[model samples]
Target: MTNNQPSPDGILRLINGYWATGIVSASATHSVFTHLENGADTAADVAIRAGISERGAQTLLDGLVSVGLVGLRDGRYRNTAEASAYLVEGTPASLSSFAKLKLTHMNALADLPEVVRTGGPVKQVATEVADNPHWAEVVPAIAAQSVPAATIAADVLRLPEAGAISILDVGGGSGIYSAVWLEANPDARSTQLDWEPINAIARRLLEERGVADRFTCIDGDFHTTDFGTGQYDVALYSHIAHQEGPEGNVEVFTRLRKALKPGGALVVCDYVVDDDRSGPAFPLLFASEMLLKSKQGGTWRRADYHDWLIKAGFEDVSFHSAPPATLVVARQRRRPVL
Candidate 1:
C-alpha cells in the first residue's frame, strides 16, 4: 500500500529560503558579481578583488552556482547570463542594490509572528510621514526592478507613437516611468508627485538620464493632495496599491480618473493576484510584506481592481501581464458630443 503524503522537499526549500537570500546579499555587498565580470575567474582572484577570504569567496561562489547565478567549470567561476545582466554593478538592468535592500528588510520579518498576531505592524516604517527617510534609500534600488515593467507599459500604450503626451506619475518613486516614457517620446513631458526627499532622488536620476528638463515633481501626499482634472494624457500608479486599503485605493483611483484628460489612460502597475487568489506565488507571498508594513494593505485581486476602477468612473478596465508586475489600464470616459 502506498501512503499519500506531500514531500518534505518543498517545505525544506521554503524554510531554507533565507540561505539563498543571505548568499545573494553577501555576494552583492562584496561586489562579487562585479569582480567576476572584471575577469576574476578563480576564488583567490575573487577574494583579493572583493576583499573577502578565499574560503568565503569559494563558498559564496559555490552558493551562487547552486542558485544558477554563477557558472563553474574547470576550477573557474563566471557570472551566468542572468547574473551578468542583472547582478553586476553599473549594468543598466542591475538589481544589486535591490538585493542589498532586501537584506535589510529580512530583519523586519523576524517580527512576522507578532505582526500577524496583532494584525498590523508593531512599528510602521512604510508610511509617508514627512520625516521618513526610507524612500530615499528604497526608491533608486527599486527603480531597476521597475525598468522592464515600465518599458512594457510604454510599449503597450505606444507612447512613442502618441506624440507630445503629458504624464502624471502619482507617487512615482524614482521617476523611472517618466524617464522611460520621456526617452521613448522626445516631445513628451512628465510630472512626478512624491515626497520631497524622493523627488530629490528622482530629479537627480532624471537629470543623469538627461530628461530632468521634461520632468517635474510635486511634493505632497497623494491622500490629501489634489490631482488636477484634465491635466494628463497618461497617469501611472505603480507599486503603490498594495500599501493601501480598499477605501484608500478607490479614493486614489477616483482622483486619478479625474486627473486624466478625456480618452487618457490610467496605468496601474502592481503585484496583482488572480481573482480567486489561488496562485501566481509571488503576489501571494508579497501580501505578508504588506501585512507587516501597513495597517490595511494586501495583494489585491483582479476582481477588486475591476470594482474599484469602475466605481472610480473609469471605463474599459483591462489587465496586462508584465512579469514581476501586472498592468491595469483604464480609460477616462470621453464626454459625449452635445
Candidate 2:
C-alpha cells in the first residue's frame, strides 16, 4: 500500500477486490446507507427497521466502517460524506441503482472461463430491451452518475444564451447534460437522440426541469438515424462513444461532424485509456465489462479518438481534464466552398 509504488499482482487484487465490492454491495443491497441516512443510527435500529437480524446488521455496518465508507460516532453508525453523496437513494448523485445493475452483471462472470475459451462473452449484459423492465431504473441511475461530469462538459463548451445556437445530445439518456446546458443557456435549444425508452426518460428529466419546451426528443439509434447536415451548432457524445469500436466511432463521428455547422464543437466524454493502456484501472476493467456487455465495445486510447476526429474532418482538437474520464473537444474544419 505504498504511495507511488506499483500495486500488488493483478490476480491477487482481482480475487480480493470483490470483498470490498461485496461489502459496499451488501450495504447498498440491504438499504443500510438509506436507513442510516433516515436515522437508523445504531445496529439494533438498523436491524429492526430494515427487518434483518441484529447480528447480520452489525456485521455489515462494521465492514463498511472498517473501509472508511461509514463512520462511527457515540455508538451510532453514519454514512460517510462520500457514501451519502454517491450511494444514498433518491438523490441525483446516488449510484445505488448502478450498483444493483453491476451486481446483475456480476451474475454473468460464472461463465467467464468459457467466454475466454470461446473469445466472446458467453453472457451479454442485460438491458431494458430485454423482457425485463429493469432498465427503466438502470438507465437513469447511470445518467445520475454522469450529471456532474456533463455539467463540467457544458461549462467547457461555454455556450451563450442565443436562440440561434442549437445542440444535439447523441444517446442522451436522462437528458441531464442537455438539461443542464439548457438551464445555463435559456434561449438555446437541443435535440436529444436515443432509443424510445431512453428518450422517454430524457423527456421526463427535461420536463421536470421545465426545459422540455426548448429541447426536442427523438427516439432512434445514432448509428442509423439521419442527423441533418449543417443543422447543429454543437453535438455531444456523452458516455456513448465507449460503446462503439474504432471504426464504428469513426462513422458516428463523421455523421456528428456532418451534422454540425462548421466550427461547431463535438464533445466526447467517456471512459478512455491512456496511450500506454497499462492502468487507471477502472477504464481498463470497464473495457472487459464492455466485451461481456456488447458485441463490439471497449475503452479506447486518446490517440484513437484524436485520429478518428481528424479523419472525420474535425480540427482544433483539445483535451480537458474531468474526473474518471477526459473530454476530447474538437471542431468541424471550417472550409470554404470552392
Candidate 3:
C-alpha cells in the first residue's frame, strides 16, 4: 500500500473503539450526566438519583473520568465541560436523546460475529427495528443529528420569495428542512410525508417553530403515499435516500418528480461518500451502522445521486457537501410529447 496508509496501530484503536462506546452508552442509559447536572456530585448521590448501586455508579463515574467525559475531585464527580454542554438533559446542544436512541437500537448488533457470518442483521429485519416506544427518542435524536445540516442546506437552497412555492418533504422525519424554508419564505407552505408516529414527531417540532399552521402532515410511508401530481414547487428527500439503496431511491425519486409542478425542484440531503467509496470517514462508518439496521442501506456518492436524479426525470442536478452530510439539488424535467 501507499505511504498514505496508517500503521496497524490505527486499526487496533478502531477495533477497541467500542470499549469507550459501550461505557458511554451504559452511563447515558443510566442518566449519569443528568444526575451529576442535578447536584448529584458524589457517586452515592448519583446512585440515589439514577436508582443504581453506589458501587456501580462509582465504577462508571471513574470510567467516564478516564475517558475525560467526567471530572473527579474531592470525592465528588461532575460532568466535563463537553459532557455538561452536550450530554446533560435540557441543554440546547443536548445529545442525551441521540445517545439513548443509538444505544437502544445498537443492542441489535450484540451478536456482531453472527451478523458478519450471515451477511445481514441476524436478529431482526429492518421493519422490526425501532419499535413504537422508541419513536419519541428516534425523532428527537434524528432532529439533533440532522437540523444543523438541514439548516445549512436550507440556506444553500436560496428559495424564492414567490407566494406560489409549495414544498413536499419526502420521509421528512422531523420536518426541520421544510420548517426552515417556511420560516425563510412566509408565503410558502409545506407538506411532510412520513409514518403516523413520525408525523407526530414532526408536528411537535414544527409546532415549536409556530410553522405547524403552514405545514401539513401525511400519515403513511413515502413509498405508498399519494403525492398529488404537479402540486409542489419543491420536494425534499432529506437524509432519506441512503436507507433505501439505489433502486428504491430511483423509484421514490420518480414518484417525487411526478408530484412536482412542471418545473419544480428536488433536494436530497444525505451522507455521501466519494465515488471510490474509499475514505471521508463519516459516511463510511455510517454505512456500517446502516448494515445493522437496513437491508440495502448504505451511503451513496454525489455522482450516483446525480445519475439517479437525471434518470428520475430531473435536470441541472448539482451537489454540495458538508462532511457527514451532502445535498443534491435538481429540477423536474418535463417530458416531451410521445
Task: Enumerate clash totals for all models, in the order shown.
Answer: 0, 0, 0
Local distance difference test, per candidate?
0.91, 0.82, 0.79
Rank the candidate models, highest TM-score first.
1, 2, 3
Per-residue C-alpha lDDT of model 1 across residues 1-338, encoded as one tens digit per residue: 24977778778878999989999999999999999999999999999999899999999998999889999899989999999989999977799999998988888989999999999999955664755778778888989988888889988999999999899999998888898899999999999998888889999999999989999999998888999998999999999999999999999999998888999999999999998899679999999999898888999999999999999999799899997689999996677999
Candidate 2 residue-wise lDDT, 222-270, digit = tens: 7789999999988999777777778889999999998998779999998
Off by over 4 Å in 3: 1-12, 26-88, 91-93, 126-132, 160-164, 333-338
- Answer with 1 or 2, whichever has the higher lDDT: 1
- Is 2 or 3 the stronger prediction by lDDT? 2
Identify the candidate with maximal TM-score: 1
Candidate 3, TM-score vs. the true structure?
A: 0.78
The segments of candidate 2 whose C-alpha lies over 4 angstroms from its true place after superposition are: 1-13, 124-134, 160-164, 333-338
Query: Model 1: runs farther than 4 Å from truth?
Result: 1-7, 333-338
TM-score of every model versus the real structure? 0.95, 0.87, 0.78
TM-score of 2: 0.87
- Ordered list by lDDT, greatest first: 1, 2, 3
